[model samples]
Target: MKKEIGSEFWTVEQTAEKQHLFNAFKRNQRFFLSGRTALDFLIKNIKAKKPIRKAYLPSYCCHSMIQPFLDNDIEVIFYEVLIKENKLMIKVDPNVECDLFYTIQYFGFVDEQLDDFIRKIKQQGKLIVEDATHSLFTAKAFHTEADYVFASLRKWTGLPGGALVWSNETLYAPASKTDSNKAYIEKREAAYRLKRRYIEGEPIEKKAFLTLFDEAEQMLDKDYRGYGCGQEIQEQIEHLDIAKIKKNRQENAAFLCEKLRFCKDIELLYKAVKQDTCPVFVPIIVKKHQRDPLRAFLIQQNIYCPIHWPISPMHKLNVGTEALYKNTLSLVCDQRYEIEDMTSIVNAIIQFFERK
Candidate 1:
């Protein structure tokens, strides 16, 4: 028997109340189609206010992280993030003055040191745009002092699409455009149908539904017609329970850690979980040779783990980041999983290494 802890679809009844979720955002908050769209909105508006020649971005970030800045004709300067002696270290050029800086609260784990670093950058009079994509369910999401903060909400909720951009100070968003989310809705529906067929042992229906899902993805990739989130996604967020989501993820992560801590072959990336942090996933590091084998074993058991990001040529020379990219595995521990699922996942990993 196999159980999957990720990839969820929601019915209308599962949606949350709008007022409850919308109330979380202040008057200055605005929604966008996606995080990249929000980033584009922020950069365009910020440039309109002041000249932005150079923007400091994280070197160990995804390519999409730098795309918006480049699209805005802003110079992109990469800064280094190193993991030294089990502690995260970040370095930036003090002499290089930038109009803005972009960074993230990686994996929802924020410490006093990270706070201090952000403050230090603030002291340098640089406009900071913090990406809270992974930290949306954490306490730091609400308490950040950054000039602009945004996140892709689709990652956390059962919504087809949504992202939010907010600032303590007033910032203008791009004009909105209306478009249909028919493709997005269909994609989710197809996924649900596919799963049902799989459970019923109907191979023919399963294949048909899978093809429907693929077609939906292709349509979505070609369709970026809307400027902001659709009404459906907005309604979904309204009904969601943020606190419970955070609690479930935290408990599930702790449960998995407790079960797997004694395994010698796996190294937990961050052993100590902070009370304030809402973990998105439990990350582990393995020998380079064991990485693919372990990933394959989990896949065979219907346990899906993701690589945080692919390593690029730039990362190859940076020993710390290169090692992390090559060996790190992010185990899904989102709010969807319970103790039983976490235990099953842990047992699967232990069995894999035991046979190795």
Candidate 2:
């Protein structure tokens, strides 16, 4: 094989264990499954009628994540993020009285601020449905007082499916008996397998992944039930020693942060709060003009930094918030990467700036 930049990074937790855990702990008051896990407390359980004024969303989230409420005939309101600010506190529309709110642990850093947001939403008698897809197994994950929480094992753990978790003392209504989407589940499993192999210094073609994605997309068009869906793939979402993952990523991040602090042109998005967060990824928000060039330079050197939440302007509401959308590109920090990997990334970035 030709000399290749070895792709080892974070490894995922086991799948079978996560699925078994899901099956055994179906103790939420009433749960539903779908493309994304949703806790429709009103629908899942018997709750008093609270007219949903609108559904509030953080502008930085994926549309598919917010689709559950939209599909259920609710209006959507967006929460603006102060991306330019130091702490990046989220700004909500106080006037928009909502019956439900979509809270995301953005890159797994939803600490005390999350609680403050939740308290405000709960006062309005609205359900705070948290997307734990990114912030799995953190201190807040297992022991949370949040009304509803759901996580996809694929994001952080080595699992094929997701879990719809809620209060341990709650019950759920069974739906989506037709899980013909097993093929998609299988594809997800296979994709992870191939991706892991390639990440482990094994060769994998980019085309192979694109082909799998196409196949999965076809299945969704044909076999998808409305909401609350899954395959019969049972598994547990497991993680490597999270403490070790956190330590490694932090060490790598700190080294890069030191290197990046002096770069007059590149804007670091958020400060690394290591102990408080199990950061899902690392991102550096750059000036709109600087983003592409910086990404290009890094890619040329095989650094492979990626962009997160690149906007799709399909939603009319996505327009006004464009100013708040800081152009961000990410550097990998999963435990699979060593500090030396980060040093190389910093060197590539330094060379790029020096060339300019």
Q: Estimate each model's TM-score.
A: 0.86, 0.78
Clashes of each: 6, 24
Q: Against the unseen true structure, what C-alpha lDDT does each candidate score?
A: 0.71, 0.58
TM-score of model number 1: 0.86
The regions of model 2 sitting more than 4 angstroms off are 1-35, 38-53, 111-114, 142-145, 178-180, 196-204, 217-234, 238-244, 313-320, 324-326
Candidate 1: residue 184 Cα off by (Å): 4.9
Tens digits of per-residue lDDT for model 1 on 15-38? 334446544656377777777777
Clashing pairs in 1: 16-238, 16-239, 16-240, 17-238, 17-239, 18-238
Local accuracy of candidate 2 as per-residue lDDT tens digits, 132-214? 76666444553244566666544544444444555544444444443434677677667666766655667788567557756
Candidate 1 deviant stretches above 4 angstroms: 7-19, 22-27, 180-189, 196-226, 312-317
Give the TM-score (vs. native) of candidate 2: 0.78
